[model samples]
Target chain A: AQSVTQPDIHITVSEGASLELRCNYSYGATPYLFWYVQSPGQGLQLLLKYFSGDTLVQGIKGFEAEFKRSQSSFNLRKPSVHWSDAAEYFCAVGPLRAGNMLTFGGGTRLMVKP
Target chain B: DTAVSQTPKYLVTQMGNDKSIKCEQNLGHDTMYWYKQDSKKFLKIMFSYNNKELIINETVPNRFSPKSPDKAHLNLHINSLELGDSAVYFCASSQSNEQFFGPGTRLTVL
Candidate 1:
């Protein structure tokens, strides 16, 4: 079974500050990885995805994540986060099969301080 | 345009009651899924349908039943809802790797 672990339950950062959200997965084969963001009272939105490609992938809202195969990690980073960036972020892992079930992390709630 | 949409964004009912949530996707995807998100923000897949055929059915309770009238629609019906059923249910569709999600239906059982 593929599982995603987001070690950070909650993170606080000042507006315009850089941010990084840690995500680690437990899967035997090279699984597909994804980052999703859910705003307050909204559904989850795909931030980015990593299949078999470059180690680093860019996503919406100036977000990027690097897939470290050796470490079994895919960490999301943003150079500067706006206040609107405050939301719950989830890390998900799935098999290469399309429309398959995805195992999502516990989700990290980000808080932005003015 | 709403690629995916769920009806009755909020559902509030008493225990032992039955309720249903409807989902529709305009993306013309052949696969649709149902997911449950607990208050703790933990998401888990409940059911998946491909071309109106049941594919993945997780260890969800039998009280929860999913119906796929077509490839673009998947509806979830819960019987004898309990307090534990008070969670947000999300509907998603995917033609390939990436899935598009509906706004979600927040169910509250009193």
Candidate 2:
């Protein structure tokens, strides 16, 4: 079965510091990887997605993710974290043959400190 | 304008009651989906419809049924609501790969 794993349950980062959220997946074939963020009491918004070609994909809100096929990882990164960036991040993987339905990870809660 | 929208932002109901949550997307996407986020915040796919046809149905209970009157609308009806059914439900639409999500409906079964 295909699955996504977000190893970090919660991450605390000081405002203005760089941040990285780890994600790993298990799939039979090359998968469509995505990163989504959910703010407090808000629905999820797509951060970035990786399909083919480009290994590093930039997304909205100054976020970027790199898809590494060797490690089966699609980690999200930000150069500088803002206070408003505190939210729960989810990494998902959808098989190429599975249409658009995604298998999401548990999620990583980010807490930004002043 | 909202790309995808769900009705009843918050719902509080008693066990054994039946309720419905409506969803509509203005993006003109051919595919729509229903996802449930439990108290633990585990988001899982429940059902998916492509152009008003059922494409994917997970291990969801039979009490929960999805109706897609059209490609732009997909509604979920739950019967005999149980306490365990309390969770946030999200509606999403997609053209091909990337999906747009709605604000979500928080359901609380007392």
* Candidate 2 local lDDT, residue B28: 84
Residue A5 deviation, candidate 2, in Å? 0.2
Q: Give the winner by TM-score.
A: 1
Model 1 TM-score on a 0 to 1 scale: 0.99
Q: Encode model 1's per-residue lDDT on A16-93: one tens digit a residue.
A: 999999999999898999999999999999999999879999999999999999999999999998999999999999
In Å, residue B6's CA in model 2 sits off its true spot by 0.3
What's the i-RMS for candidate 1 in angstroms? 0.6
Tens digits of per-residue lDDT for model 1, B6-108: 9999999999999999999999999999999999999999999999999999989999999998898999999999999999999999999888899999999
**Clashing residue pairs in candidate 2 (N, C-alpha, C atoms within 3 angstroms):** none
Clashes per model (N, Cα, C within 3 A): 0, 0
TM-score of each: 0.99, 0.98
Candidate 2 wrongly placed segments (more than 4 Å): none
List ranges where model 1 is wrong by over 4 Å.
Answer: none
DockQ of 2: 0.70
Task: Categorize the docking of model 1.
Answer: high
User: Can you write out model 2's per-residue Cα lDDT over B1-110, one digit (the tens) per residue?
Assistant: 98999998999999999999999999989999999999889999999999999999998999999999999999999999999999999999998788899999999999
